[model samples]
Target: MNVAQVRRTSGESIHFDVVENFSPFELGTESFSFSAPVHVQLQVINTNKAVLVSGTIETELKVICGRCLEPFDYPLNLPYQDEWAFPAQATEELLESALLLEKDEVDISQRIFEQLVLALPMKFVCSEECQGLCLTCGANLNQTKCSCKEEVIDPRFAALAKWQAND
Candidate 1:
């Protein structure tokens, strides 16, 4: 991202539409792979003191379903926003907390990566109707039916079950 135009004149803005292919990244034990390049539509605005970058990002990721443990494609579309102080106004604290616009061009790949990671869901499921795996046989219920009988009773609450049955 080149901010020279915006930096030269306060209130000046520039719009960009780009597609980039980023390297794969991991979150804990889960690995995220991109099926295609990420699409970004962004605007850079000079606010006198700081430059604001706001945009929409879209991509398709290959992820394992948290329930079925099967690989599937997940489409993601999200909004992103960030600000960086101009070099003259960039204080020590601002530099540490955010970013400083020092050069004519800025490599926002890191920022985009952070946004994608932050927007990830806690659990990735193929669908809401996903049946998941069978607890007893470790069989994927979505693909096939399991013959293992479900014993849902808790041993600690066995007495309560018997008491309720008597009533």
Candidate 2:
């Protein structure tokens, strides 16, 4: 558990397998199941002159539609090829390829969670062209139809429309 936190600064390398909880990504939504743990396999490597990391992050989680608020399962496979900069850079890379960093412990959960957040869609819809829900009566536009007429303007913007009417 805590080992992952030290991987970034031990002057050592890390190879770990751990479980994570259902993050906020799996909250009150529709089709997705925000359950299960995240599986991470990583290594910190240092060669002739520099430090490089290589690994694969695997996780199974649910993606929810930002529009319709539906949920769906998504599997992630992110391969990493990155450099860790401590102060300026991991200087130990010149000594051994498999070097442990001795900087302060870098939180592994924060690293992994940040990656997951970046992986999420800005607007996650179950489908590419989700119709979303009707704003009038809260009807799901994809599954049902509503008789209410769609209005383009917000009542708050009524003053802004005076110019349009005058034109």
Candidate 3:
């Protein structure tokens, strides 16, 4: 999770394969949860004044469907790349654009967590053809059909329905 050795060398590259368990508490999200450990394959390359980190993260997440409110397994394989540049004896403006490295190490856990959060979709569904639920009977339409009348509408939308009928 921390690139300690890369900071010691001027131009060194290191490869790492790590498996770590991440709890839902760490992610701070109630929409999804992880039942197994996540695998990360990373490569850290140290340049003269920068450290380049690149990797792929793989995991399976249990997420709730937004439409049907059902739980389903979602698989993820995301690639991430970033650079942390050390301060050089250059102009102050140039140093402001680069990320300052911590004392002889660069922690990548926060970055990986942020990437996973951003990679998640705003809306989750079990399948593309999911019929969701019936509003009147509160039944899963994908599993069975409901006998409730489909023409029922709120009174607030009665004017719109009349206009739609005229069109």
- Off by more than 4 A, model 1: 91-97, 150-167
- Local accuracy of candidate 3 as per-residue lDDT tens digits, 1-167: 56778877888989989898876743455645785678889898888778777889998888888888889888889997877776563346645655667666556677777888899888888999998988888889888888874666888799888999999
Per-residue CA lDDT of model 1 for 11-129, tens digit only, reads 99999899999889889988889997999999999999889889999999999999999999999999988888987998888777668888888999888999899999999999999
Listed in order, each prediction's TM-score against the native is: 0.84, 0.54, 0.77
Question: Which candidate has the top score in lDDT?
Answer: 1
| Deviating ranges (above 4 Å) for candidate 3 | 26-31, 88-98, 149-167
Candidate 3 overall lDDT versus native: 0.78
Could you tell me which 10 consecutive residues in candidate 3 have the lowest summed lDDT?
89-98
How many clashes in each structure?
A: 0, 14, 0
lDDT of 2 by residue, 1-167 (tens): 34344334445555656566745544235333445677777776443233456677677767666778767666777775455444345456533433344454444676676676667665666777788888777777877777774564677688668868888
The most accurate candidate by TM-score is 1
**Whole-model lDDT, candidate 2?**
0.60
- Candidate 2 Cα errors over 4 Å, as ranges: 1-15, 22-34, 48-51, 61-63, 84-100, 103-107, 147-167
